[model samples]
Target: MQKLVSEMDNMVLRGEIPQAVAKFFSNSAHTKDVDGSETATKEEAIQKLTGFVGAIAKVNEISLLNSSVGQDVSMSEFRFHFQMEDGSEINWHEVIRRKWKDGQVIDETYFQN
Candidate 1:
């Protein structure tokens, strides 16, 4: 599980978010905000991730703050620091819980505050 997460982290750092997202998410995967305000199906998630990856100028760093793996779900807390076209730095912090099945993520909830 840690190895998979590391691969995704590296993919993001290399600006390969679409590939990363696709590699771990199932065809019917669903991702939603923790508050249930926003949700993305597998297709939507791919589209959104493409846009996000295309918009990134450079990935400055990825920090794995913590993580825990349960029977069928895993919670990961992490931070992404990146640069925009104008050379501005941004830090995004979030905790994401993912339910896994058949070695792929079937459901994910993102927590941001």
Candidate 2:
């Protein structure tokens, strides 16, 4: 699970969020954002991630600050800096917690710092 979480985080850092979602999320996966918005399935999650990535004009940096993995759960802390298409900047820290089942993420929640 640790390796899996690391790989997924790497993929996201590289702006391969859609691919990461496809590879790591279960078909019935659910995702909740820090804002309390939710995605009920893997397809929705992929679309949401893709849209967010698309809005980024450039990725300044994406750093994995910390991480931990337990039996079926993983948490990763990340810092993101990005330039948006509208010339706005987004710099924030967030922690992603995922619940895994059958080697795929069934639930994911994002907490903003």
* Strongest candidate by TM-score: 2
Assess each prediction's global lDDT (C-alpha) against the native: 0.76, 0.93
Error of model 1, residue 61, in angstroms: 1.7
TM-scores, all candidates, are: 0.77, 0.96
Q: Write the per-residue lDDT of candidate 2 for residues 1-113, one digit (tens) a residue.
A: 77899899999778798999999999999999988899999999999988999999999999889999999999999999999999999998999999999899999999997
**Candidate 1, residues 1-113: lDDT per residue as tens digits?**
76666676567556676787789988888888655754456777888768766677987777677878887788878788878777677687988888888778888888875
Error of 2 at 33 (Å): 0.5
Task: Provide the lDDT at 105 for model 2.
Answer: 98
Cα lDDT, model 2, residue 98: 96
